[model samples]
Target: MSGLLIGYARVSTDEQDLTAQRDALTTLGVAPERIYVDHGLTGTNRARPGLREAMAACRGGDVLVVTKLDRLARSLPDARDIVAELTAREVKLSLGGSVHDPTDPVGRLLFNVLAMVAEFESDLIKMRTREGMKVARAKGRLRGKKPKLSPRQESHLVELHHAGAHTSAELAELFSVARSTVYRAIERARPAAPSAS
Candidate 1:
């Protein structure tokens, strides 16, 4: 008798859709109710709740299925750890319908190669992101969030604060900003205290 097919799926960002993965898992004979998913969670993060649940749900002779190895894990160490746990528990793994036999030399080699590729892809993505950010900074397009108040406005706010005519809340209301902003402006304008030699 065949074991139950438990499926797992994951997406790195909230913007990425899971419909295609779900469809694939269902087509691979995993029941819709047995499919677990982690949204807006990276495969490198081992603390995924859905993954934990899926692993806990597996029993001896059960099959854990994923559309791709990258969906299961992005690092070679993580992939090997998960496979080891599954193998120890006597659970089988099905990657895109191809069952992985851990005892088979060819299967182990193929799984290792796939895991290396996933990790390499992840490293390339990080490198590209850093390069893109560097270029954007050079172009003056990567300046962080703009200040909440202009220099002139901040000076006026400081003057008003020193006059003692209004409380922090009143200043905030007058400037149409938060009381924290008023306090910050006053702090920035304060003269540095004399330091002892």
Candidate 2:
């Protein structure tokens, strides 16, 4: 099936380059206008405007192309869901330089295998992070992000909050911090109750 050859390009940060992906698609003869791009947006975010536009633009026999698979999805479930949608619409996917036909059993198997590998890699990262956090906690080094307000400021914040004269918003504004920060500080300042039998 022959139709438009569409391309999608994405960069997670402003510092990264979209030139390479754009050039590759252009070299492959995809018109510059047909190529959609999302700048400074993370791949983990599924609500990318450019991606939405590209998908909306797709029709049966059309191909969705990406320079890399990660540019399309960052997780296994996300990849699987997207492939499922494309297959339902009879749209093909082109990754790197290979065109993958989701209708073919072999291609479906290959994509599912890649999705599982991606999931495994994601799980390994989470496991490593948990281990690191556990070690840090054992050393009394694991903690929430450093407070934006200093100790003196925090004390004043707690004082103002306890006075019951100011709203949390007022306290936050007075302390030049977010209302959530003021609430957290107030919570931390709660007195311990007498022990129960």
Number of the predicted model whose TM-score against the real structure is largest:
1
Q: What Cα-based lDDT does every candidate model obtain?
A: 0.93, 0.83
Q: Write the per-residue lDDT of candidate 2 for residues 1-197, one digit (tens) a residue.
A: 47888899998789999999999988877889999999998666799999999999899989898887778877878988888898899888888768887778998888778767766765776789899999999988878777688888887777766667899999878888888988788777676212210
Q: How many residue pairs clash in each candidate?
A: 0, 0
Q: Which residue pairs overlap in candidate 2's backbone?
A: none
**Clashing residue pairs in candidate 1, if any?**
none
User: Model 2: runs farther than 4 Å from truth?
Assistant: 118-197
lDDT of 2: 0.83
Question: In candidate 1, residue 134 scores what lDDT?
Answer: 96
